[model samples]
Target: MRILLLGAEGLLGTTVWATAEADPRVTELVAAGRADVDVTSRDAVRRAVLDVRPDAVINTAALMPADLCDETPEAAYAINALGPRWVSQACAGIDAVPVYVSTDFVFDGAGSQPYPPDGYPRPVQTYGITKLAGEHETRLGSERYLVTRSACLFGPPPRSPRARRCFVDRVAEKASAGGDLKVVDNVITSPTYTRDLATTILDLLYHKAPSGTYHAVNQGVASWYELCRTALDRLGLPAQVTPIQEQNYTTAPRPLHTPLTGTLPDGVRRIRRPWQAALDDYLVQYPALRTDERDVA
Candidate 1:
């Protein structure tokens, strides 16, 4: 099966690309980052889809940096909301299943527990609003669509210096530079590993799961501070990270409890692994950070 992957260079998109490319079933995968296809441009997106004519289209594009979205609302809306709309429309035109990766920010973070897939999306920030709008447009545009919402992501890791800017990178940078790190303890959610999410997305596609919204976060949850601590501890780095409230760090307010959870369809299952273990796996990739067995003494 051939698959068209949008935003293939991004964190989630990169993971999806690696996973899909490795799959023997995937005969041909046409992967496009922002350079190859401008999702915000309807004509460009439509042209790319028509040219590929793949069996499936996976959208991992978004205007991230929630605070930046608030500062530039128009650009945010155009990319986050309208970009997915174009993908959905293009997918519908070619009669292909469109899998849209969404975020936990869609919730207002008012709930005490993990939010369900069926729950109404009530985003508080402009970033969340635009993402939720994208979800609506994707749902309306195509009958064959899978909307998967996840929380904080830690990978797919950097291919080059320019592309390295995920949560883990930020923490490591602060630690290495001896800069004071203030992570929000109040903001709680799952720190999803992109590889796990990518595998699950492929699984759902294989099973031909029903078209609707689903939560694909890891089985557990943590605050941003806790996640940072885990990342540092695993890397064997000693960095004093102060836990603070979300309000103290950012210009825009964030939802306090955007953690997500829901039952998965038969094909897909929640990735049951601790964030610390995932961090360990991540550290293995960076040889400079690996602890020597001889040094254990």
Candidate 2:
């Protein structure tokens, strides 16, 4: 299947491109980063989608960090909300399925249980709120669409220089250096591997999964503390990791618990590995995580 991928240099987008390259099913992929088409411009998005004329368009571009989104809400809304609207409209014109890569932030983490894809969203911060709006725009704008929400991504560092470093890498580096880390314990999230999420998206589309939301996160959940500790332990990196109940605040409010779970459409199979297992696969990619392994004598 021919595909058009935006944010091709990003964490998830980069993995998606690489995975598509390896998958025989992905016959052709036109990878487009911001320079190729700025989604904020309706005309640009329309032009790119129509010109590429792919069977499907996967949009992974966004103003990522929560704090950045708060500092620049207008840009956040423009890219996160309005961009999807334009892409969806363009996809509708070409009868191509539009797929939006979304986040767990869309839901307020009040509930204890893992949330289903169709669960009611009550975003607490601007990032979440804007993404939720984007979700609506995608669904409403397109005849057929897919919104896949995942969280706590860890994989190869994003190709874009501006992208934030993966959390796992940060923790791994600090721990290897014996840094004392105070990680939030109660703030739960689905730890997703970019490769896994990308694979899920592709498999879903290949199966012709019906238009709707899909929770694209790994099977299990972990708080920042547990996540870090697990990675450190697996990598044989020694450090002090303390689990605190709350994180010191700055600008944005975070949901304490927003682990995602979902119902799969019939006959559509997805890679639903647990986050811990997925992490093992990810650690293999960044062998530096095991740099201390030889030093463990």
Candidate 3:
């Protein structure tokens, strides 16, 4: 499979690039960061797609910080919504499948149960609203496409110096320093490992699963506090982690519970492991991310 991966330097994009490069089935992989092609520019996207002539174009590029989105909705819409539209339009011209990485934030988080892949989205924030717009644009621009939604994505440290550290990394560093941590106990989500999500995405493409929308996340649900505690426990750290409600800690309105739960097409089995298992593998892969041995003692 010849694949064009945008946002190659991002947390999920890095793992997707690495996994695609390692896979025997992937014959050609063109990894493009923002420097290589700007998704916001329709002409640039079109040119890259025409140049690569890939069988699949996977776009991981997004402006995801909720505060940033709220502060600058136009910039957010341009990158998150218009960007995918450009990619989808380019792919449509070349008869390639466009795979868009979406978010669980698209839902309003009103329900207590995990959301289905095909559920109607009622986004409450600017970030989710723009992402939902992106999803719509992608569907409108292409006949064949995939929109995969996941939440609380964590992975190895990013290559870009400007990229913000993920939740696990920040918590691990703080715990290693023996600092008291206060985390939100509400705002439930599925903490997905990028490696697992990347693999599942590739598997979906390889199996030729009917492309619409799919939830690609680890199996379990966890609040921010529970997730931090799990990471601390895995590292054998005794840091004091205080759980607080989201209402007290956050200024932005967010979905209280948005865990993704769904299956792929019948022939293609879901390959995602439980969240705990995936998290363990992540720690093993990046041992330096753990708390210092001296700190643990």
Question: What lDDT does each candidate get?
Answer: 0.82, 0.88, 0.88
Worst 10 residues of 1 by lDDT: 288-297
Looking at candidate 2, what is the lDDT of residue 180?
Answer: 80
- What TM-score fits each model? 0.93, 0.95, 0.96
Position 213, candidate 1: lDDT: 92
* Candidate 3, 1-297: lDDT as tens digits: 999999888888888999899989899999999899989999999999999999899999988678788889999999999999999999999999999999999999999889998887999899999999999999999999999998998888666666667899889888888788999998899999988888888888888877699998998999999999999899887789999887787555788999999987654443467899889999989888766534454
TM-score of 3: 0.96
Tell me the RMSD of model 2 versus the true structure.
Answer: 1.9
- Candidate 1 vs candidate 2: the lDDT winner is 2
Candidate 2: give the clashing pairs: none
Per-residue alpha-carbon lDDT of model 2 for 2-103, expressed as tens digits? 999998888888899999999899999999988888989999999999899988999999997898999999999999999999999999998999999999
- Candidate 2 Cα errors over 4 Å, as ranges: 247-250, 266-270, 292-297
Model 1: per-residue lDDT, tens digit, 1-297?
Answer: 779998888878888898899988789999998889988999998999999998788988778778889999999898888988888888998889888888999889887978889887889999999999989889988988999998898874644334546798678766766666889899999888888788888888888888999888887789999998887777666778999998889886788987787887776754556656666676676554433421322
Error of 3 at 237 (Å): 1.6
Residue pair clashes in candidate 1: none
Number of colliding residue pairs in each model: 0, 0, 0
